[model samples]
Target chain A: MSNTADPVSYLDYQGRHKGILGWILSTDHKRIGILYMISMLSFFGVGVILGLLMRIELLMPGMTIVTPRVYNSLFTLHGMIMIFLFIIPGLPAVFGNFFLPLQIGAEDVAFPRLNLASWWIYMLGAAVALTSLFVGGGAPDTGWTFYVPYSVRSGTNVTLAVTGAFILGFSSILTGINFITTIHRLRAPGMSFTRMPLFVWTLYSTAWIQILATPVLAITLLLVIAERTLGLGLFDPAKGGDPILYQHLFWIYSHPAVYIMILPGMGVVSEIIPTFARKDIFGYKAIAISSLLIAFVGYLVWGHHMFTSGISDTARWIFSLLTFLVAIPSGIKIFNWVATLYKGSIDLRPPFLFTLTFIFLFSIGGLTGLVTGALATDVHVHDTYFVVGHFHYVMFGGTGMAFLAALLYWWPKMFGIMYNEKWIWRSWAFIFVGFNMLYFPMLIQGWMGHPRRYYDYVPRFHATHIVATVGSWVLVTGLLIFAITLFRSFKSRVPAPSNPWGGRTLEWTTTSPPPLLNFTQIPTVTRGPYEPAPTPTGGETS
Target chain B: MKEQQSLSYGSYVLVWLALVVLTSVTVTIAGMHLGALSIATAIFIALIKGSLVVYYFMNLKNEDVMFRVMLLVALVTLTVIMVFTFFDISFR
Candidate 1:
C-alpha cells in the first residue's frame, strides 16, 4: 500500500456514519455523485413530462388542450429544464465528479468540501427554478435561450428564471475549478500527461470550457435581469442598444454549452470503447487533441444559430464556414473509434452496444447539423422540426445514450451491485429501436414544411405527427423499463466485483464501492492508459 | 506536517492583490472613450487577471508540467475563439 499508515482503518470509520447525515453532510465524491444522479433524474423526468405535453399538442396542431400562451410556456419550461437542468449538468456532474479522481489514482478530489458545496448550490438553483412555477405570473415564456428585447418585454416570471440560471452557472464554475485543481495537484506518482486516461483528458478539456464559457452566460443573464428590472438598456433596441449583441453574448456561452454537454459524454465513450475492444485505442494522441479542438471550435460556431435572425450576409457566410470547420474534429473522433473497432475483439455488452449506437446516431445528427450550418439551407429549415430533430439526435441520442452506457459500465464499481445482463440487453433494444422511431419522423415532417414552436399545425402534417407521437410512447416505455431495471439491480442482494469488464483504467484497481478516500495508496502508472494488460484470472484483488 | 507545508497563505494574498489591481485598471480603461479599442483592452486585461488567478492563487505555476501544458492549451484555444469570433463579426 502507498500509504504506510493504516489507511483501511481510517476509511472504515468514514463508512459507518449515520444514513441521511452521511449523505447530506458528506464530502465523499461517491456520495456527491449519487446525489447528482438523483437530482438530475428527477429533473429529467420533469423535463420529459414537459416534452410529452409539447408533442401531444403538436399531434393534431391547432390548440389541442391549451392556448398558444400556455403552449409557449410549456416549450419554454421544457427547454429551460432540459438544457440548463438536464444536459448542462448531465454527465459532467454525474460521472466527471465520481470518476475523475479515481481514474487519476487520487485519494479524493483536491477540495472535497468544495465538491459538496457545489451540489448544494446546484440544488438551490433547482429550487429557485421550480419555485417560479408557483409565482403569480407563471414561469418565463421567453424560451431557455432567453434572447433579449422579447425576454425584456415578456410578462412571465423572467426574474425568477434568470436568477435560477445565474445560480446554476456558479455551481458549474465551482465544479470546473475543483476538477482543474484536482487534476493539477493530485495525480499519482508516475501518471504523466501522456500516461493519463482519455477520460481525464476529456474532463480537463471540459473544465476549461466550463470555466471560460459559463461566465459569459452569467454576465449576459445579469444584463437581461438589469434590463428587465433595473432598465440597464443593454439589450433594449428602442434605447439604442443592439438586441443582436444580446444574441451574440447568449450564444457565446450557449454554443460552448453544447460541448459542455458532450465532452464528458465523449469521455464516457472513450472509456467504454477501449475496455470492450480489448485493445489500445487507435490514435490516442489524435483523440486527445481533437477533444480540445472540438471545445475550442465549438465557440466560434454560435453565430450559425443566428443566421436567420437578420445577421449580416458577410457574417452569415463566415459563421457558415466556421460551422463546417468545427465538424472536422468531431469527424476525426468518429473515424478513430471506427478504426479502433476494426479487426479487433469486440464485446457486444450493453455499454459497447450503446457506444456503437452513439456512433451511428451522432453521425446522422452531425450530418443534419451540417445542413443546418449551411447558410443557404438553414434559412429554409430554421425554426423547423428539422433543427429539433438534429439536436435531439445529437444531444438525446448522442449524449443521453452515452450517459446511460457510462452509468451501467460504472454501476458495478460505484454501487458494488451486479445487474442482470439480460435486462440490460432488453432495455437497450427497446431504447435504441424506440428512440429512432421517435425522432426519425421529425426529419420528414420538418422537410415537408412543418414549422417548430407553433401550437397548431396544418392538416397536411397530421400523418407524420401521429407517427411521431406513437414513437414517443414507445421511447417513454423503454425509458421506464430502463429505470426499473436499474432500480431492481440496486436493491439486489448480490454484490458486484471490481474490474467486471476487465478494464485497464486505474479506477478498476480499487474495491467496488471504494472508500471515502478513493485510494488507500496512490497508484504509480507504468503503462499507457489503454495498453493491453493481462486480464485478471478471477476478479479484482483489492 | 506535509499538508501544512502545502498551504501557502502568503502567496494567496499576493495573488489576490495583483488580481484586484489588474481588474481596477481594466475597468478604468473600459470607462475611457477608446472607441473601438475598448473591447480589446478589456479582454486583454481580463486575460491577464485570469492568468494570475490560475497561476498563483491556484498554484498552477508550481505544479507539474502536464498542468502547465493543459493551461497553455486552454489559453491558445481561448485566443483562437476570440480571433475567430472577431473574424466573423468584423467581416460583416
Candidate 2:
C-alpha cells in the first residue's frame, strides 16, 4: 500500500511545504534532526566553556581565579549543560531522529510534527535554563543532581533550572512515544523485528527508557520547583518531607538517563563495528536483548548513586548488588562487539578507530563503575573525583566518542559532502589521547583523598590538580581540531558518494542527503541487517 | 492490507469511562491513608489505566505479532524497574 492511503502516514511522513517557511514550520524528521544538532552543538560549546573555566580556576588552586560562589555556579553550569543539554539529548535527538526511521526502512518517524515539537520544547527548556545566569539569585548551586535540603535552601536560581529540566523531560517523553510508535508500526514490507538492524533495536530500547524514566524526573523537578515556590514540603525535612524522596525520584530517572545517553551511542558502535568488520553482528539476538536488559537494570540501580545518603544498610547492599548486575548486559554487548570483530576483515577507518577507543574507554568506565558499585568502596569514593572520573570516562570516552564516530561515519550521508579523511583521523588521535590525559589523573587524585565539587583544595593536591588542568587544555585543543575539521569539510569541494563506508543497513541504500520523501518506493527487506553485501540474486544468504 | 475502517465511537467512550472510573478509584484509595498498600493500589490502578491507553489508544490490540512482542518487552522492562526500585525502597 502507498503511504498516502495509510492512516498512519500523517504521523509518519512530512508533507510538502515551500521555502524557509517550510523548514521553520515543517514537521520533517530530517529538518528536526538538523535543528537538534545545531542547538545541541551550541549547548556543547557552552558546556566546553564552563569546563575550560573550571580547569583554569583549578590550575593553581587556592582561589586562583573565581570566588567560591562563582566556582559553585561554574561547576553547576558545567554539570547542567553537559548532562541535560548535551549528553542526554545528544545522540537520540540528533542521530536517532535522523537515522532510526531510515534504519527501519520507514519514510519518517511515527509522529513527525511531534518530533519537530520536541526540538522546539527542548529549545524552550534550554532558554529557561540559560536564563538562570541573568536571574537575581544567580544559577543553581545544587549541581545537576539537585539533592534536596541544600538544593531547596541554596541561593541560586533553582526554580528556573528545575523548570527547564521539567520541560525537557516532556520533550524526552514525546520523542520516546514517537519512536516507539514508529518502530512498532512503520517498518517497510517484510522488515520483521529480527530482520531490523541492531541500531534500531537499541533505539527501540532507549525509547522505552525515555518514556518510563523521564516522568519520574519531571515529577522530581516539579516538587523541587514547588518547594522553592509553593512551599510544597515533599522534599523538605523540617516540614516532614523526606529528603531521601528527592534522591529517589531524581535517580529513578537519572540512572536510566545514563542509558538514554549511552544506548544510542551503543547503537552507533553496533552499526560501526559490523560495517567495518564486514560481518554480521555476532549474536544479534543477544545484543538486542542486552539493550533492553541494560535499560531495565539501569533503572533499578539508581540507589547506588545515593549509597552514602544514609539509606538503611540492607537497602545499600541491595542497590550495590543491582548496580553490579546492571554491568552484565553491558559486558555482554562489549563481548559481542569483540566477537563480531574476531577474524573478520576489520577496516581501521576513523569510525572503527573511535569504536575501538569506545570499547576500551567504556570498559574502563564500566570496571571503575564496579568500584563505586561496591557499598564499602562507594562509601569512600562517594563525593570524590573517582565518581567524576568514572562518569566522564563513560560520558566523554564512551558516548562522546561514539557520537563523533557516528558523525564522521554518516556525515557524507547526512550532508552529501565528504569530510577530509586525514583531518578526521588527526582529530581522532588528539581526542583519544587528550581525553585519557584529562580524566586519568582525576582517578589518581580521587584515590589520594581528593573530593569533587570543591572550588579550592589544599596545596598538597596542587600537583595533581595542575596535571588535570593541563590535560583539560589538551582535550579542548583536540576537540577544537574536530570542530574545525567538520567546518572545513562542510565548506570544502569534496563531494560524497551514496555509500562511503560500504554499510550494510538500509540507510546506505538511499541517496546521500536523501530526498524529502526518504524513499520513492518502500523497500522490501529480504534478509537480516549487517549481512555482508554481494549476496546471491534470490536474496538467500550465500 | 485491509481497508481502513473508522474506530467505533463506543470503544472510545467505553475506554474513557473505564479510565475515569479507575482514576477515581485510585484517588479514593490514596485518600484512605493505607500507607504502602495505598501506594500499591494507586500503582495497580495506574497500571490498568496505562494498559487501557496502550491497548486502545495505541491500538496494540489490533497490531501485528512483532508489535505485540515489542510492547510486551517494554512492559516487562518497566515492571522490572518498578519492582526492583520498590525492593530497595520497601526494604529500606
Candidate 3:
C-alpha cells in the first residue's frame, strides 16, 4: 500500500468536531504531536527572545538595557521555559508521538487518549508556569535551579513556578508510561526488538528515564512548594534542613533529564546518518544498548554537579569516575556514526549537514563535560561560565542541532512539503558560526573566573561578553530565516514525494504524511531496520 | 493481546479500602511524633499500598511476564537511586 495513497490525510481528515476543536479534541497521536510542535515552537520563540534580551543586557556589562533584577528574572524565565517547555519534551514529544506508531507498524500509541491528555497537561503546565510571572509578586528571581535558601526566601512566585514544574512532571511520566507500554505491547507481527529502528531504541531508553527520574523532580518541586507554603523547611538550612540534600535530589533527576533531552536527539542522528549515508548503520546493537546504558549510568552521575557543594570525598570521587564512565557510551555512538559514514555514498543534504554539526558540537560538549567531571578540576570551574559554555555546547549544540536536523529531515514527511534548500543551507551556516561565537567565549570567560547567573561581569570579561551578544543576534537571525523557510513551505502547491529521502525505516514506506491508519494493511517485518547496501556486482554487502 | 481475566469487584473494593486505611495510618504515624520512624513507617505503608494497586488495580498479576520484568526493572532502578542517595548520606 502506498502510505500516502489515501486522499484524506490526517491533516485534512474531517472528524466529528469542526475546525479548531477537530484538532484540539482529536485523540489521534499525529494531531497531538503537531499540537505539541506548534505550541512548543511558539514558546521556543519566546524563550529565544528572552535569551536575546539577556545577551543584549550583557553586551557592555554595566546595566546595558535591563536592570540586574530584570536580568535575573529573564534568565530564570528563559531557563524554565526552555527546559520545561522545549528541551525536556524536545524530540520525543514531537517526533516520537508523531512517528513512533508508524515506525513500529502500529496504528497509534497504546493509550491514544492518554496521549492527548499529555498535551493538555503540558499546556496546563505551561499556563501555570506563565501564570507565575503575572499572578504573584513578580517573576521568580531565584535561578531555575531554585537553590534552597534563596528559593525559600525569594518573595517572587517561586511556589507557583515550581508547581508548574510539578504539573509538567505528570505529563512527562504519563508519556513515559505510554511509550513503554506501546513498545512492549504494540510492535507489528514478526518485528522483534532487534528489528526496531535505532530511533525507537533511543525513545525506549528515554521513556524509562522519564518514568524513573521524573518522579524525583516531581517530588523535589513539590517539596519546594511545600517549603514555600507550609513552611516545611525540607531544604532550608536555618530551618534544620540541609541544602546539600536538596541539590542531591534536584540533580538526581536533572542529570537523567539531560539524557531524556539528548538520547532522542541521538536517536534522530542514528536515523539520519544511515539514511543519508545510504548504508546500514554501523554497530546497531551497540547504539541501541548504548542508549539504555547512557540512561542508566546518567542517573548515578548527578553527584558530579555536587563536587564543590560539600559532598563527601568518597561520593565525589565515585561520581567523577561514573561521570567519566558515562562518556564511553556517548563516544561509542559517535564512533558508530563515523564508521557508518566511511566509504558510503554520503549525501551532504541540509539534514546531514546539521547531523554532521551535531557530532562536532556534541563532541565538544561531551569533552568539556569531562573537564567539569574531574573532581580536582571541577573545584576550579564549578558554576563558572565554563560550565555555562559546556552546557550550551551539548545542549544547544548537540540536542539543539539534532532537533534542527530532525526537522529538516522529517519535515518533508511530516507536512508533505519541502523547504527551500538555499535558505536551509544559509540558516545552517549562520547557526553553526553564531552558535560557536555565542557560547565559546563563555567557556573562556568562565575559565578566566567569571561566575554564571551573575548580572554583571568584571571589565576583564567585557570583550568575550560582547562577542557572545553579537553571536546571539546572528543565531536568532538564522533561526528566523529558518522559520521563514518552513512557513513558506505551506504555500507550495506541490506535495512532497512519499519517500523523499529514500529512508529505509517503516515511516518512509507510506506517503509523505500518512493517512489516519498509518498502514492500511499491517506490515510484517522479517529483516533488520537498515538493510545492507548492494554492491555493483549485485551481491549484498554489509 | 492479553486474554481478558475476570477480576472480582469485591477484590478491587478490598484493595481500595486497604489503601484508604493505610493512608490514615500514614497520617496517624505522622501525628504520633515518631520522628525517624514516621518517615520509615509511612514509606512501608506506602509500599504496601503501591503493591496492592500494582497487583490488583493494575492487573499486573495477569499481565505478560515481560510486563512484570519491566516493572521489576523500574523498581530495581529506583532502589539503586535510593541506595545511592543513602550511600552519600551515610558516608558524609
Between candidates 1 and 3, the TM-score winner: 3
Q: All candidates' lDDT scores?
A: 0.83, 0.84, 0.88
| Model 2 chain B poorest 10 in a row by lDDT | B1-10
The clash numbers for all candidates, in the given order, read 2, 0, 3
- Which of 1 and 2 is the better model by DockQ? 2
lDDT of 1 by residue, B1-92 (tens): 01223447886788788888898898789789898789889988888888887776677766867768867876875686677667655665
- Per-residue error for A233 in candidate 2, Å, reads 1.9
Candidate 3: tens digits of C-alpha lDDT, residues A1-542: 22434756788888999899999999999999999999999899999999999999998868989998889999999999999999999899999999899999999999999999999999999999999999868999888898887898899999889989999999999999999899988999988999999999999999999998899999888888888889987776677898899999999999999999999999999999998898989999999999999999988899998988888878888889888988889989999999999998987789999999999999999989989999989999999999999999999999999999999988977888878888899998889889999999999998888999898878888899889999999998899899998899999735777777767888877766788878768888877888742322112111
Per-residue C-alpha lDDT of model 1 across residues A1-542, encoded as one tens digit per residue: 12224244222445546767778677888778879999999999999988888778877767777788888899999999988988998888888888988999987789999999999999999899888878968988888888878898888898898899999999999999999888888999888888888888888888888998898899889899899888978766677787888888889899999999988888889888888887789889998999889988887788899998777778788889989987888888888887888887887788888888888898899899989999999999998999989999999988998898888889887876777777878888778887887798889878877888877788888888888887787788888888888889867735766577878889887777676677767778888888865554222322
Interface RMSD of each candidate, angstroms, one decimal: 2.4, 2.3, 1.1
Give, for candidate 3 chain A, the lowest lDDT window spanning 10 residues.
A533-542
List residue ranges in candidate 3 displaced over 4 A. A1-5, A532-542, B1-62
DockQ for each numbered candidate: 0.31, 0.34, 0.54
Best model number under TM-score: 3
Pick the winner on lDDT between candidates 2 and 3: 3
Put down candidate 2 lDDT per residue, A1-542, tens digits, no spaces: 12223232222334576665566577778778878888899999989999989989999868778888988889998999888988998898998999888888898998888898898899899999999988889888888888888888888898888889888888999999999899888999988989888888888888898988898788888888888888878876678888887887788889899999999899899999998887789989999999989987887788898888877677788888878888788989999999999998887888888899899999889889999999988888889999999999999999999988888888877876777778778877777777887898888889888999988788888888887888788788888888898899768937666677878888877766776667667789988888865652112110
Top candidate, metric lDDT = 3
Model 2 residue A501 lDDT score: 80
The single-chain TM-score for chain B of candidate 2 is 0.89
Q: How good is the docking of model 3, as DockQ?
A: 0.54
